[model samples]
Target: MIRIPTLRHVATRSLRCAARGAVQQRRWAQVHDVRFLTTQPSQAILEKYREKLSKKASQEGHGSIDDLKAAYSEKIQEQRKKDSTEGTPVSQPNAPSSFPPSKPAPKKASSSGEKPAIKPLGDILDLEKVAELPEKELTAIWRLRHASSPQTLCAVIPAPAYQAMESLARSNPYFVLPVPHESQGAEMHFMQWTFDPASKTSTVLFTQLAEYKARGEFAQPHTTVTHHLDLIKDKGLVLMQGQVMEGRNVQPDHAKWLVMCLQRFYGGWEQKGDELDGQRKERAEERQKLLEWFTNGDPRFSVEKLLEEAERMG
Candidate 1:
């Protein structure tokens, strides 16, 4: 025979169930609030794996883990030194606390993403006694901050002017020398360059492949050419003489294209051949466009104007 349960017993059982549900809900909310949960490999999990890997490495007699830790330590020390020198606040990377006590990241100085302030040409020219500055600094000061096209295509600029162009070009993502363009498809390859301010000369080393191969990304330059230029002050022309130091791997077709570019852009020579072919005509048209862009177009290299505006604003 079944007996009826007491009302007190039923009420007590319901209360206990509610309490367990509340506890579970609170635990789930805490997990949801953790920021690392949304990103790949939660920080806690990463640390756990890292510790396991370190232990394994130690046992295997490979110091990979120790080396990585040492490198990170050195980086932290360098950062601290820099901060101290610059009078900025420093934070230790290996602090006991893994994460910062909930704080928002600092806002950037400019929200609009505007370009940096420009100084006037006059102010730069009239600077007090001048001493030799590093090549990088000189490049920065003399940089062509505004140019119409990626390819400057200027005819014989002075050493200083060309260097300024190179400064800007180096910063560009697509800065490949011997850049072929015409009726045929483009063949793009990387280029590395070095400059000597005293001698007013530059050397360009062109790579063979557009992208990395099995051998490596950078093999010795397929073609190495040193450019010696004479500055014609009155005409504002740069007369370039190229000496091909190395071209063992350069194909015949590629060499022809390279010479054409060197003559048209650097040497300030018009494209000429026994036969006036389509390629020659195309190059001539390109040259004309560049000339028009430089002469009629703004060309936008007035440092004085920019600096004056900056000072006026101040």
Candidate 2:
């Protein structure tokens, strides 16, 4: 019984071996028998192969990698061909025209031996509006005129005085006092009020005889008083007084009295040779040289001489 069982086991093992050998032989036959192309494939053959791959993929219900790649390449080529053929010019936004025709140059002034016509003094004065400015502004305008020169109060007066004058001219049209000629011998003098005005202002401008002469060239001296008053009224009486005091580096009290003496001599009967009432009148006349020296910008006019002269007069 044991011999029979062993023989049966051997038979079963042999059958299993035979089945394995058959599978191995079939696999080797398949690998060896299948043929591959020996020559380089043509483009047409590759295309046909691609088509077959696509058909096979479609039948199997999925897209192949080669099929998708071929489709993408064809789309790109179509886009490039369309772009090359169309060649559209890009539209640009409108820009402003460069260098538009320039305006023609103005015609030159006629040289027909005709001088520019001068406007009348009345027209130049602008009097209707001139009358409206306050007295302080008028004083300022007069001060502005004399204060313009370097030899006069220009050296003594602060920069603000010049600025104030400029500001006054800009604000009030009447405050415009244009120096007519460069060579016009304009002289300016400052004076204080002895008998104060009803307005209680301490200072006034006293135009010298020289200024009077220039006044005759343009208009009467007294007629220009409106213009003068327009200057003072705008710049303010106290402001002028403060400037005089600051410029001279003197006490306001002394400067005030000195200015009064000036006003007395310039405004009073000194023009007529008639004497003023008090000893102050005589003293002011005696001090005329010093006053002229001060106005003339003479650096040599010593404080010693001024004090000595003051002592003699006193």
Report the C-alpha lDDT of model 2 over 218-274, residue by residue, as the tens digit: 111211111112223343322232222223223333333333333332322233344
In candidate 1, position 36 carries an lDDT of 16
Model 2 global lDDT (CA atoms, 0 to 1): 0.30
With candidate 1 superimposed using the best TM-score fit, by how many Å does residue 311's alpha carbon deviate from the native? Answer: 46
Alpha-carbon runs more than 4 Å astray in model 2 = 1-227, 231-258, 261-273, 276-284, 292-305, 308-314
List model 1 lDDT by residue over 1-314, tens digit each: 11212322332333354456554322111111111111222244336568786877787776876564454554443332222122112223442232222222232223435221111122222222112333343233322221232221112245554543354334421123222222222233444454544444454545543222212221344444334342323333332322222334445445434544433433233322334579655554544344233233334412222222212212
Q: What's model 2's lDDT at 133? A: 49
Q: Where does candidate 1 clash, by residue pair?
A: 119-307, 120-307, 121-303, 121-304, 156-238
Model 1 residue 128 CA deviation in Å = 31
What candidate 1 gets wrong by more than 4 Å, as runs, is 1-174, 177-187, 210-218, 229-239, 243-247, 259-314
Q: Where's the lowest-lDDT run of ten residues in candidate 1?
A: 28-37
lDDT of each: 0.34, 0.30
Q: Please provide TM-scores, in order, for all candidate models, with all chains considered together.
A: 0.28, 0.19
How large an RMSD does model 1 have? 29.7
